[model samples]
Target: MKSLIENPKDVKELRENGILFSRLGSDEEVVELFKEIDTYGLGSRYVFPDVKMRIEEHCNSKAKTWMAELIHTYFRSPWTAVALFAATFLLCLTFLQTFYTIRPAN
Candidate 1:
């Protein structure tokens, strides 16, 4: 490209550079994206051409490994997820209903 951008003075300068920006979840869409320039949008040009990344992330291998393990365990047996959720929900509902409460006598 022809140095599409330089030290942008403001939104106006950014527009002239053909690089529009917007929030990642603003629902502005690709067409409406360039119409507005936001410094708060998530930018991942590979996945979302209209998204503008305005935040930084710091991570460690521990979290990555945990997430990977969780995903693998979840999909490996979807029934496990369903059963676990159902069991937990039923337990909460039962507790709320007090279905097993013992009556006290005077």
Candidate 2:
């Protein structure tokens, strides 16, 4: 956690997300606290090994990563999302019209 917080903005984001709470003074104080804390003697002990392993597995999955990238790229804005929906609808309508035109009617 200390390594992750490099500046006051990082501290502010963590505090906004309820991940960090400090009554010392401000976000800068929280950053300073993390900086001053000594983590050299912390013994190696698994607090939640299973949860960590599950998170690692999820991160390693290619399908999940691809899906996340797809969403982030195409659905980041409302206009892009609407454009994708309209394109898909048009393609489906084109396919149906082609099928009806090629079919023999009684």
Candidate 3:
């Protein structure tokens, strides 16, 4: 947590999300607190090792990374997602119609 916070804004975001609460005067105080905690050099034991491993695995997966990137790049907007769905539906309908036209009637 100490390593994750680089500035007061990071502390403010954590506070806003209820991940952190400080009785200190400002977000800067929280940042300073983290820095102070970092100097203590906590031991090697991690609180959530399993969760950290799972997150690392997810971040390392190539297919999932590519799919996430694709969605982030092309489907950032709702309208783009809707258009892709509409286009896929039209394509499937076109393929079905073509197949029916080519086959003999029962």
The regions of model 3 sitting more than 4 angstroms off are 1-32, 35-44
> Which model, 2 or 3, shows the larger lDDT?
3
Per-residue lDDT, model 3, residue 12, is 75
lDDT of 1 by residue, 15-87 (tens): 4445566445533243344445544544532343222232112123577668867978775788888988999
Identify the runs in model 2 with alpha carbons over 4 angstroms from their true place: 1-44
Ranking by lDDT, best first?
3, 2, 1
lDDT of 2 by residue, 1-63 (tens): 766576898687668757788888888888888778776865434445676567568868999
Where is model 1 more than 4 Å wrong at Cα?
Answer: 1-60, 99-106
How well does each candidate superpose onto the true structure, as a TM-score?
A: 0.33, 0.54, 0.58
lDDT of 3 at 23: 97
Model 1 pairs in collision: 41-52, 42-52, 42-53, 43-52, 43-53
lDDT of 3 by residue, 1-106 (tens): 7655769986876787578889999998888787777445565446456765675687689999899889989999999989999999999999999999999579
Candidate 1, residue 43: the lDDT equals: 53
- Least accurate stretch of 10 residues (summed lDDT) in model 3? 38-47
How many clashing residue pairs appear in each of the predictions shown? 5, 0, 0
